[model samples]
Structures are given as C-alpha cells and as structure tokens.
Target: MPHDAKAAKAGTRPGGRSARVRTDVVTATLAELTEKGYDQLTVEAICHRAGVHKATVYRRWGGVDGLIADALALSADQPWPIPDTGNVDEDIQLLAREVYTTFTDPDLRTTPTALIGAALRSDLGAAALSAFFTARHQQAAEVVTRAVERGQLPADVDPVELVRAATAPLYHRLFITGEPLDERAAHRAAAAALLAARAGLFDAPAP
Candidate 1:
C-alpha cells in the first residue's frame, strides 16, 4: 500500500538525525536515478543505498514521486553562484557561459541531465522542476538588478526577464532541439539580451 500524500508534504526537518537522514536519502536518490534512470528507480533500492529503514522513507516521503519532489526542493534552496563582474555585459556573458559549461561538460552534465529528464516523466517532479527554475531565475536576477543600480541598464528593465533572455536560448538548444552548443552561441545570446534590454524591449509592463 502507498503512504499518505499528506505525510510526504511535511518536509524535512533541519538539524540532528532528521537532517542526516534527509541528506543520506537524497544522495541515494540522486545516485540511483543517475545510474538506473527513472524507469528503473525503486524505493527498495533507495532504501538499501541510504541504509535507512524502508518504513522511514515511506512515512516521510510517501513514495518515489515525493522523494523526487523533495530532492528538487532541497536543491532549489541551495545557493547558486551568481556572477559578480563589475561590468554588466561580462556578468551576463559569464551567466550564459556557466549554463553552457554545466550541460556540456562531461563530468558535470550526467547527474543534472538525468535528474531533469526524470523530472519530466512525472507530474510531482514537473512541479518541483518549475519551482527549481523559479528559484534559479530569482537568484540570477541579481545580476540585472545590480546593473540597473549602476545605470548600466534601464531602470525599467525587468531583471528576471533580462536574465531569462540571456540564458533561454542555451536551454532551448539543449533541452528542446538538442543542437550542439558552442562558446560563440553563449556569447551571442548574452549580447542579444543586452541589446534588447538597452532598447527597452524588456521593460516591465506598467502595472
């Protein structure tokens, strides 16, 4: 029998045994998902890898879907490295370059790529994925915010929109068209986003 969904929504408690358990379980989940892919992932395998009792996982996370969601939720709360170059143009270019490096680098790509691919296979994971991107966008928007403060960008430009514009093409090529991404493409995307922002094309709509 499946565990209650309400139990899964309780979230991981910070500190002590609960925190350790959450860490172990999430680590195990990522390992299993990376090694076996989503279709082959199983609660029993996760339990064995985590070395935590099956009952504990079921009672806290409910099932595989809940585990996946919580994993993404945890990831979202973690700090992402936002660029800090004094020049807004360099910062934006670095932002796009970071994405390109992450997805295209052999050592860095496997786990995150597998995690996102698995997330696309389930509704619970999908919602978590949405939250994950939202959190990332908010964090990255700081680059644009600082640029505006320095008068490098128009005050009316939407920070999140500018950040999104800078990096969205790489994501489209990566997750959609499966096109090969190059350094030139990353630079081009950043340039186009900056040009549009300068032209006031990404100004926040009057509310």
Candidate 2:
C-alpha cells in the first residue's frame, strides 16, 4: 500500500486519505498485537503487516506504546450493543452474553489482557488502561442508569458499582485466577451481579 505523506502528517482525527491511513494502521496494529505478545510487537512488524513504511507508523504513532494505545482506543470505540429487554433479568443476561462474546473473540480478547498486563508493569500503560476502563465503565453505567429510570432496576442503584459488579468476576477469572472464559462462568457471574443489584448492593443510602 502506498503511504500518503499528507495523510500521515494530518491531525490525529483525520479525514479522507488520513482517515483511511489511520484505519489501516489500527487494523495492522491489532493483527500484530494479537499474533505477537506485547514484548515482541514492533513498529517494523506493524509496518510490514500494514504494508506501510516504518516512517508511516512512526510518524503517526511515534512508537510501539503509542501504537498499542491507539489500537486499544479503537477497540474500545467499537460498539457494544446493550439490550433493554424491559425485564432486568433478561437484560442482564443479554449484557452477560455480549461480554462473553467479546471475551471469547480471538482478536479482541488478547488485546485487553495485553493492555492490562502492560498497565500493571508501567505507569504510562496504567494511565492508558485507566482511560480505556473509564470509557468502558461510563458506557456500561449509562445502560444501567437507563434501566433504573425505566424501573427495570430499583430506584436508587448506583449504576457504576453495578456495572463493576457484573464485570469484576470475569476479570478476576481472566486475570487474577487465570481461568478460562467459558459460558458457564460468564452466566454465573452475570446472574450473581444482577441478583446482588436486585438485593440492593448498589442502592443509595436513605436520607
């Protein structure tokens, strides 16, 4: 692929040729990151995979870390369809299934784990990880908040906490215990979190 110099030089949020280049870079980075662990991921490797010159990768992303951050941001930006099934139980199941699907996706699953591992080992990585999670949490919170407003949930639930509860177990299994991300485990965790929320674990204190 021919590298467009003007596109490479343009601002981060690009249009036209710049946007196409950005998309290509991100796609290439994701492929490299998935195939090779973080330690082995290189600018040269991304450039080779992306069919762009090393200078193009360097000019756009600066380095491997910058590239990974952009890839992660792109992954995070991918739509997470949240269902509002009118019944909280059903909605929670749908959310859990969605998460399970994501965790099992060959391409996506490794990216987050790699990013989180990097975050644990480096301050800069940690900041990037924090930003990623903050965006994810905010999105999840909005879904839960909408559920609460619609009376699909209790009146006083803290959507942020509820979202965390739903996801924490899966993270724990994936990161803490290094267990498999299987369907049974996902369903159990989702059910537990929804049950707890229904039981008022995330409810606001009465005045």
Candidate 3:
C-alpha cells in the first residue's frame, strides 16, 4: 500500500472505534485475500476474524467488494514508497527496488498478483484494482514531480505516466514473465523509463 501524507493530513486516517474496527477488518481482509483470494473471500469469514458482526460490516461496507476496496485504500494510506532523494535516477531506482521488495515480501507477495487475477474477472475487482493503482500512481508521481522541479525532467512530463513506465516492466517480470528480478533488472527498468522520459515519451499530450 502506498499512502500520501497530504491525504492522511486531511482526516481520512481513522481513529477510535472506527480505527479499531477498520484495522481489524482490513487485516482480516488482507489475510483472506492472501489465502482465500477474491473469488473465495466471504464477508462472514472476514467478520469472524474481525470480531465484528456481519451485519455491521454489510451495513457500512455493503459486501466483500467494498471491504476489498477499503482494504486497498487502507494499505495505500501508508507512507509512500518512492523516495524523494533529489536525484531522478536514484529516485526511480529506489522506486523499482521498493516495488521489487513489496512483490517479494512474503506477507504481501501474493496479494497484488491475486488482485491482478481478480481484476481480470469481475467489475468489483476491476474497481478495486483501479483504485489501488490510482493511489499508487498519485504517490509515485511525487518522484517525477521532484525531478521536474530540479530540471531533471521536462516540464511537460506526465509524472504519473513516468512512474508507471518505470514500474510496469518490473511488474511484467515479476507477475507476467515469471522472470527473476535482481538489482540489474531493477536498474534496467529505471534506466529505460528515464530514457523514455528524456525522449519526451512520458510527456502529456497537447491540450
């Protein structure tokens, strides 16, 4: 999960009973996603783990899809992964490494891949995946923003697309190609994205 500080500062961060309940539900939701996957996940099971009544969850969340969506938002609310170290190359490298680390972490490794699979199957899943990526793109775009401010990138660059281009190849290797990811692979992805950005490939189209 990638979270921006700006949003957290705006009061979306939960607290008190709401926080407690959200923590429990979200934790349970991830556990279920990691184990049972989207298709097999059930509200009853999540409630059992969260220790909240099923009706309580249903009334607020509507069902499993709502829980899944909020669970993603909860995770995205964490401190963003992209480092703002003032060097575009280094920042993209850091971003790649962070993506690699997340996809390889035992606790989180399965969830994204599973969600990708889910995204291919249902509208709920597509929406959740979209929201997740939207949050991540927002967070990642920061690195590019820093780069542009420092003149490392053209002012016309699309920050979000730049970040996405950097990470997409890494994800392809991790999830689609089943290839091993290492420092070399990570740097390669970053460099390719940098090259593309330098070529104005990531620039926004003229209005």
Candidate 4:
C-alpha cells in the first residue's frame, strides 16, 4: 500500500525520490478528501496516510487548505507543452482534453466538489475558491491568447471569453445538472467554441 516504493528503488533517477514523496502526499490528501470531506480533512490525517512525518507535511504545504490546493493543482496536467497542431481547432481540442481528463478523475473530483461546497458555507473557503478560480482562468486565457497571436484565431478574439465559453458547459453538467462530463460533451464544447472563435464571435466589442 506504500506509494513511495519507486522512490526507494535503487538506481532510480535523480529527483525521483522527491517526486515520489510529493506524489504520495498528494495521493494521501486526495484519499482523505474522499473519505472525510474537506471539513474533516487535516494535515495530520494526510501525513499519517502518506507515512510521512507531520513536520514534512507542514513544512511542505504550510496548512491544510494549502496542501489541498497544491494537490488539486497537480491533478491537472501541466499547462506547458500545449500542442501546436497548426490549427486552432486542434489546439482547442487538446486543451479540452486536458481539462476533461483532469476533471473526470475520481480522486480529483472529490476535492473540487468538496471545496465548492465548503466555499458556499464559509467566507474563508469562498475567498480561497475565488483565488483558485482566478488562477485557473488566467492559465486558460493565456493558452487562448497564444492561439490568437499565432493567427489561428482572429486578432480581435477575447481569449478570456472564449475560455469561459469552452468551460461553462462542463461546469454546468458537473455542478448544476448532476451529469457526468463525458467525452462527447467535451468534444462538443471544444468544437463549438473553436468554431465560434474561427468565425470571430469572440471578437472584442467596439471601442
């Protein structure tokens, strides 16, 4: 059940041990989130499950929400290496795939859902959620803007708006409609947004 075996293996690559430690910590946090909900989750519980010392978790993450946020952020694949398929449609599809993959992971889903619920009930949670959403949106906007700069999208496209259109449907399905965000939905959302962007629907309003 230990998640750090690879870290302990002989001849493992440099950074492998540290990477595995981080992975174990994230995994433990996720497990705790699923089992106890965010309200009941604690740094001590995560440290216990990860088989790491309390000081290790504290020194690394600072506190419980900090640990949870880091774990959730890692669940999303890194944003760098965004594909350049020589076409806006292809790039949109790739971005959608990454979002869908991250959101659909069972373990990752619990943390976000719990966080959202907590946010609704607590001012501190609400503030944290606002910051988290802002960071996530900024990253998505950067990718959309890069596509625009590459001439794949119209010069006037509002990257932030385009990203919101692409992700709004998924949020509705997951949070409002209580439906699963399946592959078909992901493809439809991406394709629709890409088409609109191609047609200049995302163009900025007249000054």
Candidate 5:
C-alpha cells in the first residue's frame, strides 16, 4: 500500500487514510506483540506486517514504545460496554466477571493479555497502561453512579474508586502474582468492593 504522505502527515483521527493506516499499524503491532512477545518485537517486522515503510512508522510513532503506547491509547478511546442490569450488585458482578472471562477465555485471551503484559515492560507503555485503565475506570464508574442515583450505593461514593476496587484484585492476580483466577474469585472481588462502598470506604472526601 502506498503511504499517503499528506494524510499520514496530517494526522487525522478516525475515518480517513490516516485512520486506515493507524488501524493497520496497530493491528499489526498487536499481532506481532502477541506472536513474538515484546522482547522480540521489531519495528521492521511491524512495518512489514503493516505494509508501510519504516520511516512512516518511526516518524509517526517514534519507535516500538510509541506504537505500544498509541495502540493502548486507541484501545482506550474505543467504546466499552458497561453493564446495566437494574441492580447494582449484579452490575458490579458482571463487570468483574467480564474481566475474568476476557483474560481467561482461550479464544479471547491471546491478544489482549499479550498487549497488556507488553505494556508493563517499558516506561512509555506503562504510562499508556495507566491512562488506559484510567479511561476504563472512569467509563465503568457509570455503573456506580447509576446505582447511587437509584439508592443502591452511598451518595458520596467515589464511582471510579468503587469500579477500580471491584476489578483490581483480578488484575493483581493475573499480572502481579500469576495466580489462577476463577468465577468464585470474580464474585468475591465484586462483593468485597460493593461491601466497602456501602460502608463508605470509597466515599469521596469532603472538600
């Protein structure tokens, strides 16, 4: 594919030559990262897979870290499904269960799991990972916000905090301790986060 210098240089967002290039590059990045892992990943490989010149990748993304960061940024910008089951507990449980399922399911696990693990290996990737989680937590906090409005959770509850609490343990086990995750663990994480929120442990401090 011929690189549209103008479009690539213009750095357009979503729906143009630039977007197409981005999608192709990021997709290639993920595939490369998944197959080769971060340690063995190379810019030449990514560019070859993406069918773009090495100059384009370097100019736009700087290097491998930039590609990793941008890939995560793109993922964060994408829409995520936040559950709404008309019950706070169920919504929270569903959120935790979704995380568990995504990371553990064989067909679903390879790309995302590899992507996240790769993000942890470098500074730029780590920063992007933090921003990615921040975006996700803020988006998922809608569940707690709606629950509070429905009198299901404390009015002062910190929605992001509650959402983070519910999902942190699963991530910790998956990434930090390398322990096995199960359905019961998912349920427990959700329950514990909810219990803490109800007890005002996640309440926002007064200004």
Candidate 6:
C-alpha cells in the first residue's frame, strides 16, 4: 500500500502529513516492538514496516528509545474509556469487560503484552510501560471514585487498588496460566474485586 493509505489505516488522530507520518511510524514502532521485542528492534525494520525512509525516523526520533517513548505516548493516547454506570457492581463489570475485550483484541493485546514484557528487562521499556499503565490505571481509578461518590463503595477505598484488583486476574490469565479469557472470566474478576473492595479488603491500613 501507499504511504498515505498506510497512515490512514494506522489511525490518524490529527494534524497534517507530519502528524500522519508520526502516527504511522509510531504504529509501526509498536508493531515491530510487539513482534520482535526491544532487543531486536531496529529503525531500519520499523521504517520498512512503516513504509517510510530511515532518515525520517532518524531526523525525528534520533534513536530507538526516542521512538519507543513516543510510541508509548501514542499507545497511551489510544482511546480506552472508564466506565460510569453510577452503580459500583456494573461499573466494575464494565471495567473488567473492557479490559478483557482490549486484551483479547488481536491488534491491541500483543502490543501491550510485549510492552509489559519489555518493562521487566529494559530501563527505557520500563519507563514507557510505567508511564502508559500509570496513566491507564489512574484513569480507570476514576470509576471507583465515582462509585464512592454514589455511596456504592467505601470512602476510604483506594481507587487505583480497586482498579488493579479488578484487572489482575485478566493479566494472570494472559501472562501466566494461559487459560481462556472469556466474558465469564471478566464478570468473575469484576465481581470478585468489587466484593473484596466492599469488604474493605482494599481499604488503606492505619499508618
């Protein structure tokens, strides 16, 4: 496909050719990272995948770290809405199901899984991964906050902790046991997390 068509398929957010090029490059960067990992990632490969010249990448990013960092930012910018159904149970269910859908998405899951794997091994990868998840968890934490506002959850419930609790099981299935991540699993995760949170399992301890 042509470069413009590739950029369009990559998902253009805004701006002109520069923005589209950056998007394409970042999309390519994530694809390469997911497929080949950080150790084997190269600008040449990413450029080839993106259908852009190597000079464009070199001129803009300077190196692999820069490219990965920008790609991580772009990944973070990708849309993932926080659930707000006004009821805690439903909210938690929405959160988990969204996570399941995202992780099960053939295009999205590999990117994040690869980034998470890279986080454990490389400093740059760790920074990128941390920034991405920190933002994501922070956004998801708002669901618990909204639940608290509605008296659906305890005032002292830790939002991020609740979010973490709700999502951990899905990651466990994805990375560890390799079991099926079905809708049933999503509902179970949300229910268990909300139950635990309601029981004060996620409440902060006395200092």
Q: What is the number of residue pairs that collide in model 5?
A: 0
Q: Write the per-residue lDDT of candidate 3 for residues 1-207, one digit (tens) a residue.
A: 357665564546657567768888878887887799877889989999888999889998898777777766676677685697888998998998888777777776687666566554667656877778788988889989888989999999999988888888887886578898777887888899899999998889999
TM-score of 2: 0.79
Clashing pairs in 4: none
Candidate 2 residue 76 C-alpha distance from true site, Å:
2.4
Clashing residue pairs in candidate 1 (N, C-alpha, C atoms within 3 angstroms): none
Q: Is candidate 1 or candidate 6 better by lDDT?
A: 1
Whole-model lDDT for model 5 versus the true structure? 0.94
Model 6 RMSD in angstroms: 4.7
Q: If ranked by TM-score, best first, what sequence of candidates would result? A: 5, 1, 3, 2, 6, 4
The better-scoring model by TM-score among 3 and 5 is 5
TM-score of each: 0.90, 0.79, 0.80, 0.64, 0.92, 0.76
Query: Lowest lDDT 10-mer window, candidate 6?
Result: 117-126
lDDT of each candidate versus the true structure: 0.91, 0.74, 0.80, 0.73, 0.94, 0.83
Worst 10 residues of 4 by lDDT: 72-81
Candidate closer to the true structure by lDDT (higher is better), 2 or 5: 5
lDDT of 4 by residue, 1-207 (tens): 354665466425566667778888988887787789877988888898989999888888787776666664564445545656666677777777766776788765666676565444555545665666566666767777777788777889888777777777887887678888898898899889888877889888989
Model 6 TM: 0.76
Candidate 6, clashing residue pairs? none
Alpha-carbon runs more than 4 Å astray in model 5 = 1-14
Each model's backbone clash number: 0, 0, 1, 0, 0, 0
Better of 3 and 4 by lDDT: 3
How far residue 192's Cα lies from its native spot in candidate 1, in Å, is: 1.2
3 or 6, which is superior by TM-score? 3
lDDT of 4: 0.73
Candidate 5 has its poorest 10 consecutive residues by lDDT at: 5-14
Stretches of candidate 2 above 4 Å error? 1-14, 105-122, 204-207
Top-lDDT candidate index: 5
